[model samples]
Target: MKTANEKKNKMTTSEKTSKYLMPNFGVRDFVVSGGKGSWLFDDKGEKYLDFGAGIAVTCLGHAHPRWAKAVAKQAAEIAHCSNLYMTRQQADLAEKLVEKLGPGKMFFCNSGTEANEALIKAARLYGKKVTGAEGKKFRIVSAIDGFHGRTLGALAATAQEKIQKGFAPILQGFSYAKYNDLKSFEEQMGDDVAAILIEPVQGESGVTPADPKFLKGLKALCKKHGALLLFDEVQCGIGRGGAFLTSQKMGVKPDGVSLAKGLGGGFPIGAVWLAKPVQDIFTPGTHGTTFGGNPLACAAALETLNVIEKEKLCENASKMGERLGRGLEKIAKKYPGKIRLTRGVGLMRAVLFTEQYPNAAVCKKLRENKLILIPAGCNALRFLPPLNVKASEVDKALNIFEKTIERL
Candidate 1:
């Protein structure tokens, strides 16, 4: 086999990826070699402090020992087995999640979109069974600018029109309610509303956290209207936003929670956690997934949880997130005309720029410097560094961020 430099010179990374992969995602054209902690190394040996963490997926940093061991051990033992027969790893992982959530059950999947898809299904099923609200009454109410996923069911719940465009005749029975506005949500709440789906921190539309008042009030409204409250914790859960369950810190117990991203510490895993009563809604064969709780994924997730517990990533996320936020605020104040707002929780943060300095431009600049980031909404710069991103790394990132903003 030709060496990297020899091969890199012959065929660009972009060439290989574009020729092989689907065009659904915007690939950065960087052939990543490896990562350690908060940084990633390209095949060219260029170092980049990854602030995006693969879009907020690697919470415990990269290539950690725990994860490496879990993957290795599980692979050697049993990489994958169908959900037909019960697997020990699967049972142990489920039991562990049950213990963590307390009086809840778990349905494993492989992506946030799939988790949301399952949650949507369960809510409709509950509506049909419990409330006797069949086809017409099984409507989902989601907040504007909220991103559930790209699957048809979750896509229909997504608020952004650009994503849903051309996918004509979307999944029906979904309604949009104004985010952070209870009056709008109240108006939308009715017998037809089977569930209200929301993100604790809107990761895609910039990291705008849901107000406690809106969350608490949404729960009350759900209860009053006999609708289940679903929290799309895909981006905020598993110590991303300073808590295991961010809604819990606000003292609200949602009936359903969809999680992915960091759940498997970079491995593909998504879970829909259900409250006690809501747990029993799905009987055998009622819902299923092929790769949801396979031994490889379960082992990775089990160890990911352990690493979070042992390393106290939640505490680290809180401290680093505050430091990052404060630094961003200072930058925003210094460049008030360009930097419009900075909003986020823990490591999940976004810096919205004035229309004069577009978010896409800022994102492009960041990527040019080999820094990986993503644009949220139309004018927001999203950042989701690893939970273990150090103070030194944070400081360096701030400098890079400042330089990037100054150029604008």
Candidate 2:
């Protein structure tokens, strides 16, 4: 008995997504229409506090006026001219990144996966340069739980069996090492190994941070063996770790760094920074991307970095990180056996629940309470709020989290 318009209006967004899109993601019922700073509005006009921040991609929060304005201005001027010709925006962005990351050259891409892939290729080229052979010295050693990307080349670098399950015949010459174990990496390293790739802060695998001493050890080891030390900072860089790069905060210099996510503040962009020693390894025709470092993408990334510095968001992240850490610890104490542990650095944090309460269940309950979170690993939920998040917002989120835990 319903009219056609009414029937159409009654159809939920989840239903449309299920019908039209691939079933790769475990789609939730929440349908986001719009968002403001630290908050998202569902199609029903219900607002939810967004702690996940689009998986740590929205560093400036939703619809930031300055960011939006810069993107609009750039789009009006020029959007995609391809990588055939260079633009001032691209040049300026590259200069800024090189200055921040030390003596390095920058290569732009469209996502973290692409950035990591570029680094892998750079490592291979360096290997061939050093050994004077193509496939002889092209092995890469990565952490057992580290995640590089979904592409075959990147997936081979990633050591998780779950992520690499269906992808057969993954690129060869990749080795695995235990995270935070210097001896394990030493065993994997040899004259044939080109580089060691790892995440300083493993965001996807429960927000575990690499020990400072461990990273320093790897640096020395790489130097001893003429192997490159590459940090996958895709999730922890660009002010997320209370510093521009986690390697900088730890005082360990890596040969190369791959970054994305927060770099564009919700816009799609990625970059790889290679130190001067290996910077010239890539020739003109060796690698290229059509949309990488275009004017519009460079504009977004440049403005994102500018805002972070001007607003002192990195300093804010440090302070708020301390506050959030204390809050999580207190909650952990309140429910003795419920939480196994809480860990992370800066705004990238996680709460590992006991086996009794699964991460998915807790995430669902938090979403039901209008507090969104991202499930990580097997039993942890990540809290990756924006860098500019206020103390009051942190308190509100904590209160909601505590209430949800009590109910469970």
Candidate 3:
């Protein structure tokens, strides 16, 4: 008898996806049917270990009982109302986020790009307030090879040529600095520079972490130049980096921080937290979102936070990250020249490869072997397992990785 997945697979590829979805993404072969903690099942009932965690969004993992219940319950009661009115769930979520991060007022949005756009607007407003002129002191400095988002403002802030291609005349007032190089950043700073935006861990640029000293120095520089420091924690926050905020773990504070990805577990939500100095910058009519801070999203986020705290997932992430790192180091040692380096914090990790090794091919093979990983920039493979992943799952993934490397 043909299984349900078999029947579904019988449909042509074009019929399955080409009709409705845009052709931007390269659609994979199999159709995902369902997922559980640390695992995903395709339409054919074949299971694969989930190390990518839906590109680091599903921090608590798939089909989490608590998150599911909270989202469903909230949806049943009330899903959304325009931001004109306040909801208890939104207030609760904002309070929780403030408690995790330092004193700040939050503006809720629907995605990371929106969060970052808000940060940009806040910085621009701060600049206008300081200089008593619009467009003066509004230039924002961002690091090269950093990925912010696809929106026009965020895209302009992003320094990659490939991302900026075809999006000409990108919103002005943006400049680029080299990551991890304080001097490169210093050269860009001036009286007109309003903000320095960067990711604590450069998730898209091969999981490169910002040095503690560099972050501290950057904070000092921002203070000296009277500019705001914006940390894009869209991918590294929400306990994925073993801290509520990666900057918290690094002992550095920024004037504004953007968060999304894992913040809502599986649901869509985004937020920007502004420190006391800039919290009041966005007064009425300054900025707003229609579905942001809606009851359903907040309920999901609140429950996600609750689960992270109750399960001690942050501690688990630290422990598992250490174990995963040690295992990767061992593998790197075994394959000396082929494996260039391994870098990251908590579970947000990457293994870079030598030019001779094809990262894309190896990643494809790993997927064939039922182990999923994210292909990061700079010829690196990223491993973003769930915070609550077990040691045995790590071992299993390592075993598959070793076999693949051996074959190479």
Candidate 4:
């Protein structure tokens, strides 16, 4: 039934993917051709409401005008230059971040994993400096079920066994503690402890926000042991949780913070902000990246921040998040047995389901129904819409969610 021209122009999803891409990820049935606002369009022209926002990377939404303009302008000017030279865009972005995140110095990288790796290196250097060159104070404590990244150093900091299955002999000096339990964390702390790293909100484990009291206690414990406190805000930072940094809302300051995801507004970028005391640990030769603070990436990030501020997207996230939570609660009430609970802050929300319905199945069904949502551990579905999401889109997603539950 197809014309010769149409057949020539078309290629099956399998044909397009099987040849070029790695087999690590399971590719979806449809190929995404384009996206706008909170919607994505597939090659077959099916429209999907994107609640995942590329796993919380596109905080300003798809194809945002200002972000596109900034990237285009910068690309035309200068897309990339090695770190050997300084670029105005990169410096400007750094200044903006430092101004927003308190007095600190920042190091740029390509992703969250790299940022956490930098944090790890910085912590170890600080430890060596404080406790002498041959000191044993290099162990870093992280939380159970917390996700950092897949790289060796960051993976070592991550506490999931499944992710570390075959990649054993992970870098030494990493310990695990129970999240949200101060006593469990204390058990891991010692004179040799260099840093305590945690996520403000555990996005991968299921939208688990850190308890304010637990964060405060950890800070105190770190100080007592002469260790640094590091927050991996990759998933919760850059206005994702109604604040530039979740620690700001929690009223606890970390000695260092790793950020990525929404910081670049879909461009690949990462950063680590270090407080004054330990900021200078990384001397000239200690750490570096080839294309970290390139002009195009910084321009995209700067514009993302500008839009977030000018449009007051943080305030919007809080308001819309409340609306979203209320809607989910109402749905939970309607399907008491199917839905167990809902949790999260700002737009980073989740719906926990009963054992009868598995989270993976729920996510698959949602995708089939032209809705996109991410599955977290613990039988939960995460909703990480853009910070500038509209109330109407939230309602539409809720309607689809309710119908999906009914069918299930």
Best by TM-score: 2
Q: Write the per-residue lDDT of candidate 2 for residues 256-353, one digit (tens) a residue.
A: 99999999999999999999988887799999999999999999999999999999999988889889999999999899788988989899999999
Model 2: lDDT of residue 315: 93
TM-scores for all predictions: 0.95, 0.97, 0.96, 0.96
lDDT of 1: 0.88
Full ranking by lDDT: 4, 3, 2, 1
Candidate 4: clashing pairs of residues: none
Candidate 1 minimal-lDDT segment of 10 residues? 128-137
Off-target runs (Cα >4 Å) in candidate 3 are 1-14
Relative to the true structure, candidate 2 has a C-alpha RMSD (angstroms) of 1.8
- The true-versus-predicted C-alpha distance at residue 334 of model 3, in Å, is 0.6
| lDDT at 325, model 2 | 90
**Candidate 1 vs candidate 4: which has greater TM-score?**
4
Instruction: Give the C-alpha miss distance for residue 311 in model 2, angstroms.
Output: 0.4
Whole-model Cα lDDT per candidate? 0.88, 0.92, 0.93, 0.93
